[model samples]
Target chain A: MGKYRPGRRALTGATIVAAASLGLAACSSSGSDDSPSDGASAAGGSDVELRLAWWGSDSRHSATQEVIDAFEEANSGITVVGEFSDWGGYWDKLATATAGGNAPDVIQMDQLYLASYAEREVLSNLADYSALDMSHLGDSVLGMGQVDGAQYAMPISTTSFTLLVNQDVLDELGLTLPDTDAWTWDELGEFASSVTEASSGDVVGIGPMNNEYSLQLWARQHGEALFTDGNVSISEDGLASYFQLALDWAQSGAGAPADQYSEQAALTLDQSDFATGKQAMSFTQSTQIAAYTTASNGANLVPVKIPTEDANATPYAYLKPGMYWSLSSQSKHPEEAAQLIDFLVNDPAATSIIGTERGLPANPDTVEQLSGNLSPEETKAVEYTETLDPILGDAPEIVPNGASDTDPLIQRYLLEVMFEQSSPADAAASFISELQSSIDAA
Target chain B: MSLKELNALAANRSARRRSGGKADTRDNRAALGFLSPWMLGIVGITLGPLLYSLYLSFTNYNLLQSPSWVGLDNYERMFGDERLHQALKVTFTYVIVSVPLQLAVALGLALALDRGMRGLAFYRSAFYLPSLLGGSVAIAVLWRLVFGASGLFNVILGLIGIESSQSWISNPDTALWTIILLHVWTFGSPMVIFLAGLRQIPRAYYEAAATDGANVWWRFRHITMPLLTPIVFFNVVLAIINSFSNFTQAYVVSGGTGGPADSTLFYTLYLYQEGFGNFRMGYAAAMAWLLVLIIGAVTAINFWLSKRWVHYDD
Candidate 1:
């Protein structure tokens, strides 16, 4: 005990401090460390080794492993080595690997970097591959992965922007929220203020505007497209109104405190305002109820239609592909890669393992199969996704090629407004120009 | 050696080379043979990238495309780039404020630990612990937890009747300071160096001064300070250059957005964001060159100004 006691507690202190940064250092270097001669092998031979990389959660990783196991059992001779990363560092790893021509066989693609990677020809066009199958998926689902009429990726799931109501917070306060389906943004704000008042400032109504989706939805509501025809089309006024809602909420005591909001902006889901039970509601993706349920310390959250200006607008929301599977242009085994992706999206055995972990499956057939057996939180995600089908407008435009940099830009302006360093109008004006230039440059 | 001594040695080497022919030539050939691997490594790995990046600094390369020549365009943009200016300002503040404070703390600790005391190894390793872990992402996350709203920091504040719930690391006014504090907290490496310098200082001078009725302050000022100037200069140069290159601490601490409003936007973090995050490799290269120039100029100034105050035995 004495020998162990010397380092036992001291090691814990050092371990806690040295942990997270090494993960990133390892990830950034892995691209260079991997065999540069990758993808030059596995030419339709038995026991083909393929690398499949994606950014996701622990649950998603396990589910993906299960899918891979199922796929391997069903189709022998092909092996998939999985590469996973958190979302923050994923693109850096993917881009560096893809640029070095050592990209994994199957690459998980995001809408932000999708067009850029597609235009760069780093992703293989699925249309040219005969082994791939997308016939079961609808035209919209197919179009989600198309850039300028070329299918470069296969959409895995569909999701919509939504308002997640934390029933546990309301129950704790002995209060009820307003009708989420037809409420206006202002009415939502008022309810938030009431929650703040009832809880004596312990909790707020809505979380901070850290993510980009809320702003996009607001722009569309005001008859502006965030990006149209490869350019930023949202007006300064439309954007300011979005920022204004955030500022107004903070000042009105209907939102998380400015510092708390800013802090929450960069925190993990488990530490988020809504997840930590410090907020009654959150504007997030429809598929998030499952994740939020887990993140929120036993907070029973329900995903519902987001509040609008009039509430009667058809397509009060818009659906977007949650993620896509892009076959690497460098992949020597594109046929095998496509078969694996096809299995993940359309096959019942794979869908059973996946459930709503990656949002509702893009294929209607898989979505139907998942509905009866999903976990309660996953069911909430599927049910909420179903409720949006009638009201959701045409699938939103794919993020522009160069607009991947705009997320940080949006957060910057959002912070500026929240901090009172800049007015909403001023921040919006700067953001618009910056956004336009980045898109133009890209 | 001083610059004058270095020049004299070079002159001496050349004279020896001119007079002593065969034996020197044989030695040179052997030296070249021994140096071949390192020369190859430098050329292949280090020098190649350095020269390529210098060329890339003038082009418009985004890692995905052919680097089109756009002479001075990247440099021209850096002049007007507000975010780049902000990043420069943040980096300069971090270096200026943290380096002296860090040196002072390191010097203080080194002096205190210089005295033979009980459990010296334990104390030394414990103090050196933060230096090892401070720059890591885990420590930054733990830092956030410590200074978070309703975190231990606020709880400590509460105990002293200072009622506040602001997350120190998240507040724009205080975020930079928190990072600077982290920088200062990693004084272990410098402290160890200072301790080594202290050990190298002879006790004869202090003993002589003590016999002359000199006080601790007088002895430290006249004898110890002069002897330690070289180490102090070395530490200053290293610390300044290191502070400029610091990325991980700020990148991880600020969650890579350089926020609560670009307050912790260290220059290397910005360069990394441009090169890797934004994929503007050309601009990043230009920024990297600019950083090299800044560090070079500052180091040159340090060497030039060292003539006035840096003491040497010669």
Candidate 2:
């Protein structure tokens, strides 16, 4: 065969050279921005530029912007630069920034990324930010932000993957709401089926998102979790049960069919069958309700506690401190940066504007101050959560370093089982074995 | 002659020679200077990463950790990795099935349109448009809508009383074919190439064959077939490369899982899952190298076989 034309080859060659230069530049810039100086002391609260980055939905974006503006106005010496993106792109951007060592001064970290970040030494230990006082934050919320023995970031608020109910749907279908606080899997299935049948297919009872929330809930219920130090904690039986529910729903048409799911998956939640009023209930986090509510425009939504199998098998939800405000280990103005973070999380005015946009406030004082100001739905969610507070389980170890990579693998096996190509037992066994090995190697 | 007169004559001759050669030499050097930038890039950029990746393929280097020398272990591991096998099987099946079917349809459409149709350019552009956007996320998303249970496809099927399984995307058996059909639908590029090749075929050859009482089928078999062989060969090679590298559509449609029992688990998607998603960069690098070798070997075979069928008019 003839060789590639010289002109085309040369163009390709030049393009590669340019790309390499850009990559090298990106990698090198981080080192210069982060890391401590050899002899210079931390900068005073002068005209310091502090970069703050976070990921959130539109509501969080607006509220956070307002908080940032108030913080900047109150602290004239500090310049807070904000960067934000949706959840999907946030991690990839953070990882690359961490690798470069030029991470943001005040970063928003989730439990999913906290351990990995701490392990990689990308975040400054917030315990070192001596200027900021966090004595007022709740232990349950503050506890998650700690890595190893040292605190790396301050938890802003505590959130969980709670279930949102359409109370109107239940009322219309003439079915009483299941005891979500400690309902078993069998009870949930029956309730959903009855609702669907009674409505003549006008409503599909529940839309279970085959995501981390479901897996986490299922894992905890079975007396295990997704990860234990270096290996999987959930038993094969637990995984089989998880896949079985998803499959049974699809098979019985209690949820969207598999083919329909594949197609509907192409669209976002806003364009999904549920959003279009074809489905009644959906499993989601309390934070996600803001978007659903705005889209549904108050369609009789209610936040329910995650259903559990029994008292012994009580569902243990996570208080994801709505991510954390972390300092880059390489900042020149570490003190001022810490001050900026202190204002964002602890200051009353900033908290008021931010409201529960982050989540139910982790600060007891802030929660108390905003009690009467909350929307009816927000008040209900907060009350529901407080009632279930005593049942809250201990937080697991920070998500393992390779934790982010396992979702697709889990989804693959789950999909296989859903389509009946692989039996639940076999898929569960294969998934656990393969994923453990993969995580261990990583 | 005087000594001064002799020196002046020698200096004049040397100055004249220098002036004459300088312009020509400078022109030659200028041409080389323009070309050197490109030549340097080939060695430093293109070949540099190429060789570095090859070296990395033999090591255990995750993006976070330092690379450890592992000899051929990384490559050897591919033989045992179940996901790798599945991805390769899916990728090869896609290439083998989709490429030929797409090319045939493209050629057929090109031939049909060559019959002096009105607004031919409009039709050609309309047909060519899908190829430009076939691999994009939007199309992948649209593909989901068209084939979803509540999708347009199901609605159409329902009208005719043909009930379909709701798990189109979730069904392993049909997921791969759905992707294949999408690949086939983007026949615009190859069709345009075929049309171009058909135009280059001499009209006189067809007339001469007609004079020999050759029917349309015979004329096409003898005249059109041999002449279009070069384009056919080009299309096949290109299709194989493209199908092997297919990522965006599958990634978007499947949410990067390549799911439904791994039926749509393309090689690149699997590699991404292993590397970025799983943080198994070392394994991913090894997988990438294996894919290169496979694609290289397949292309080599295609070249070897082309001598038998590919013909050039020149």
DockQ of each: 0.22, 0.23
Candidate 2 root-mean-square deviation in Å:
7.6
Q: Candidate 1 lDDT, tens digit per residue, A271-291?
A: 677888888988788777777
Please provide TM-scores, in order, for all candidate models, with all chains considered together.
0.91, 0.85
Weakest ten-residue segment in model 2 chain A by summed lDDT: A22-31
DockQ of 2: 0.23
For each predicted model, how many residue pairs clash, with residues at least 3 apart or on different chains? 0, 8
TM-score of 2: 0.85
Per residue, candidate 2 scores C-alpha lDDT tens digits across A306-326 of: 667666655476655666778
Which residue pairs show backbone clashes in model 2? A34-A330, A35-A330, A258-B167, A259-B166, A259-B167, A259-B168, A260-B149, A405-B277
Candidate 1 residue-pair clash tally: 0
Best by TM-score: 1
Residue lDDT tens for model 1, B154-227:
99999999999899988888999999999999999989988887887777778889999999899879987877
**Which segments of model 1 are wrong by more than 4 Å?**
A1-31, A36-45, B1-26, B117-119
